[model samples]
Target: MRAALLCSAAGSLLLSTLTAAPATEDRTGAAEMRGTAVAAARAKAAGVDFGPCPDAQDLPGRMQCGTVSVPLDYARPDGKRIELSVSRARATRKDPRRGAHTVPRQGALLYSPGGPGATGLYFPLIGLLPEWKRIAAAYDLVGYAPRGVGRSAPLSCTDPKRFFNGPSPAPTHPSEAYKRERVAQAKAYARGCAERAGDALRHYHSLNNARDLDVVRAALGEERLTFMGSSYGTYPAALYATLFPAHVRRMVFDSVVHPDPARIWYRNSLAQSPAFERRWADFRAWIARHDDVYGLGGTAWEVLRGYERASAKLAAEPAGGKVGPGQLQGAFLQAGYYDDQWPHRAHALSAYLKGDAKPLVEQMEQHPEAAVEAENSRAVYVAVECNDAPWPTDFRVWDRDNTRLARVAPFETWHNVWTNLPCAYWRVPRQRPLDVAAGPGELPPTLILAAERDAATPYEGALELHDRLAGSVLVTERDAGTHGLAGGPNACVNGHMEAYLLQGRLPGRHAECAPHAEPKPTAPGSRAVGRSR
Candidate 1:
């Protein structure tokens, strides 16, 4: 997931200082010149109305939606304008007291969940994060879909069918044929999206996103902005501090990504495959301990063998007559992202072992949009990733590195490589990824949170980011799941975040939190959970 930050600054920097801006736009008659291939997309998308989502429960405050205009290119202050859609929940408790600081209007806390395509506008309904609400009470809690994502000028193909509808073909191992074929597919996907997105696709880089955040800050009427970022949002927030440090106030970055310019944003996922396997073993061991329940195996090794057998079975005769590698991988990927879903996975797997295929099939089809979401996610993902840094153009280099990594991380090696296949067709060539060097010149003192076992954003990445940010105080969860471990009911993790949000206190000297325990499962005959989010 990603976090969001805001920054307010003077008008754009000139050409010499504008070296970092992602694109250049012609200024004359720019408003009338919507002459890009995406004109049809923009036009068709325009009619799809998104009415303001009213908070029906009357929880505490009201939410308002508005648009902020930013330059298409930050280097040219007088350049064409791009609209950024934003929403805000005004402070619930407003103080009327002595002039100035006593009266609250400090600023807004903007948030994003870090997909190059993940929607940030739904923060209010995400019950998992209660800490976000607490912060909203004091400061306006605002969220916006970044460019090329969600309601703010979405990025999609003209005939965007379910991207992951078909079964995925599994590769035995990285071989010459596999490398060439997959590379071609990746390039094809990228080309399709580029042809689809047209000019809008070119502006989908992180630099533009960072500039968009600043525009949102200005529109919100904040003199300076506070930030709370996680995962990919950390990259944009960090960029804001560097490009315009003086505008930053207090900030928090959770599950930060490295901003080194040399790194390939998409290729980076390639390196993470083996790491995911390491965590998968931990998961298997946990499952094997309950062998009587799952019956996969009594040992982790046996469990892996069982999985291989199941996968092979499905490969030979597709499950439920339709299930494929895409569905299986999607189910497996869910467990990798968060530990809370482990039971759900266990239930599906156990049922499958018992020759009951419905549960497993249902789980795989839980979110058909998941695959499409994965695709669109990859589009925005590559737009930002490719622009962030240069990737090795040589197929041999990628093949060699992936081949080496697959030796150990075979489970996700091919899966990840295929996931990023679109990068080969990305419209923009490699640009320097931000070198995230946080210092006195950038960012205020920040609070950073990380779960020890988070596979997506590993703990080491958090520690490294913490080291870079001079004002950052790191809170380490001894054993936890997923990236955003805060705002949950965990007293240790939640309490630390609460204090940071309400009282601005950090845990002294890198405090540790107890691992989270999964909620006990309900028996078949137990009363039903009427509804769930």
Candidate 2:
């Protein structure tokens, strides 16, 4: 949730540099409409509105909380009114001084937390990145949950635990029966979501979310929109630019996702497994050196075998009636996102291997605590991923792809499959995915940041996106393993971002950001992963 993954009212520009602009009155048609909807939706959805300018009285300008009513289906916009829960913190420095009026209206920024499900309505609260406060000072930082996500009309499936702790598509034998069960479980999850969510499910597409951003913009009364999109949010930002180019002012897409329609994300993530396995190996080697602390394995190979054994143990008897292959794999996926958390995972693996069971038990306990948030997570994730393109209904395809992938990348292949298995059964109707190579849709100068070694959204994907975004400047965090590449606070990456957001300067067409120095030892006082957040 720290990265830009949540949805919010309107779109935004990534303003690194600042400039002065006129401070207008507090009236906004967009704000008014949003306010009305917020009041109404709050009555129905029981969402918190937080009203206007709550704690910002100390600040200079006003902020508001509200919602927008969108259709359950874009084709039938006039049909059922699906509520988009939203919150806004308007420009605070706009009216402080006359000479500073131009600078006062620092404009606003819209952020996305990428889950299509993660909520960022609390961007300020999330305190994303140590430097975010500086960014928020000049601009209004606004965020919201997409439909079927936090505070928004959420989706809940029966036997929700099954979603987290079910048997995945992986099998040691890779038998036809295994594939059948995988497909059945996937399809059942999809049907369960569809049966409960119905029309609400259909409208959760990224395109719709992008359009909802427009409505948010209109409601906010902003002349233009600025955005920071990561992961799946990149799709909506791209789509919004294509659908309404004029509305966009500036945008930044991090950890870019392939907008191609032909490939299912399940397939794409499978492709990433090898890369993650590579990262895990690196982690395991490090853990070997620190065996005195972890004791899970005496060598990298031992640690590797330990994880395999843990997976086998879970497959035989899921921990605490949960933490099956899916949960274990899902947890690993989170761990793999960055290097700082590797120790946490290593410790958990070590403890589990020793049969202490506390760490793994602790991990399972955290799941139920996040149940509501997890639903929001699953809802938004499936909504956008499912709608982006049609997934093959044939379970045989998934079975084949996953089984083939698990051969070399056994780490999370089946686990990844089960994590995304619900997509095969997504209740929402499908739409065409965006073309990654489709040139940027008349966007303002955008900064594209990519890790040279990102596994989730591979570096090549960024290169592809850069090629498509004619006005964008691409920078590579050379050899970095993490996706998105922003939180390192490296002088090369952060300086470019700061220069862009504050000065509106674009790096040369292809900028090469210096790689971070070899990471300092992970002992105490070292810069840990997500330290910025």
Candidate 3:
């Protein structure tokens, strides 16, 4: 995971630039409390608490780990509750240069680490980075595992090994047999979830996640919220902003998700197929430019043929009796998310074609813990996405559309289909996506960042979100493709991001950031890294 995607506690503000926000009355007691008959269904109810964090002795000030709780269903606040694993780090240091105890704390920043399922108790670890050091002095940092995530009443369908290590149908061009297998797999997976989790799956959607944010805010005794979310995290952050606009002090959404009616998620994922194909070309082209070093191909087409050949060989005889065609493609998929890893992935591919499979096998992340993490992330992803909105229940609608998309964009169309097909058979009833525009209190201006060629979340999604949230500013990285833009290599994007969080000031209605140069190959003494315009 990118450390940048995980933010920590807030810190000292550039006093000259920081603006203090007004206090809003705490609304903890504002929401009506209901009956207690359902209390038996819950584990212990919890409040925000902080204490020593292990293995973080070197951290500035101190890092704390604790627990908070939210109802499984907000409609019944006093009902069955689930625990939230939370971490905190306060940037409440005194500075004499300004004045002793002169800087009042800026509101703590609540961070979401991209995965709707990603465990975020590690959010404060981002403070380990030098870039966030100055930013950390302004406020406390808060991190949590949302409901149904790790350490937060986690939901699992079956023996995770079956879901993680089980054989998968070829994601490449699939036949009717392959399609049937996938449909069955998806159905079984959904059924397993129901058997294991029961009605709990219904509460795993984003609206509830947003609702839980309020419980967290009230627990912290803060009147307002200052939030930063990345990737899928953007979805919930936007929901929190719209559903509770008055409580928002500031927000930053990086690599925005487009949850509009036309392509919110079902269609949105289909779009990623083509986007990944385009990004694959970028990776292929880069490899072609360094043909002499890799000896794989002299052009993008040639490089692709090398990949196809490798996939065929792997499919016939799994590399090291483990990595198959599915593993091969999965290894390369990382290039679509972060270009910085391109050189590394390409080298792995190169080594594989030359009859050495070590590098390629490593990309599969063979560690026992890696499989566990992947399974949990996948479970949460399916639970949240399927429960969030409606999907055509008919497998034919999914197959027909994905087949059409695969004809033109074959890189990940079917692969993505199988990954999300579980949604079609999802047992939970779906709701319409919430209107992410301003709430009744009216939202303040927000800052949104997008890479021009983000494969996971297209740049246009950011533009769409900019339109949805009135007064929000949009920052574009002209030619980049990384998934999380803020706290990335782009200094310009981070400048605007830090300023917004620190000063609560909005940049221009639209801002443009130049993409940094593609990374130089890391082959020994190959070349010194250079910056691109």
TM-score, cand. 3 vs. native: 0.87
Better of 2 and 3 by lDDT: 3
Per-prediction TM-score: 0.82, 0.79, 0.87
Off by over 4 Å in 3: 1-47, 53-61, 92-104, 166-169, 439-441, 524-533
Kindly list the per-residue Cα lDDT of model 2 for residues 91-197, writing each as its tens digit: 44533324345344456688776666777666544223455544554567777777778656776654556444444423544567666676777777678777887
Ten residues in sequence with the least summed lDDT for candidate 1: 3-12
What is the C-alpha local distance difference test score of each model? 0.62, 0.62, 0.73
Task: Give the C-alpha miss distance for residue 217 in model 2, angstroms.
Answer: 1.6
Best by lDDT: 3
* Residue ranges of candidate 1 with Cα displaced over 4 Å: 1-51, 54-61, 94-106, 126-133, 172-176, 264-267, 366-375, 519-533
Clashes of each: 8, 28, 8
Instruction: Give lDDT tens digits, candidate 3, residues 36-128.
Output: 112212222334667765445755456788776677776566668787777888874543335555455786788876767887777776755
lDDT of 1: 0.62
Q: Which residue runs of candidate 2 sit more than 4 Å off their true CA positions?
A: 1-64, 90-103, 126-129, 159-175, 264-267, 296-299, 313-325, 364-366, 422-428, 436-441, 517-533
* Pairs with steric clashes in candidate 3: 9-141, 10-139, 11-136, 11-137, 11-138, 11-139, 12-137, 12-138
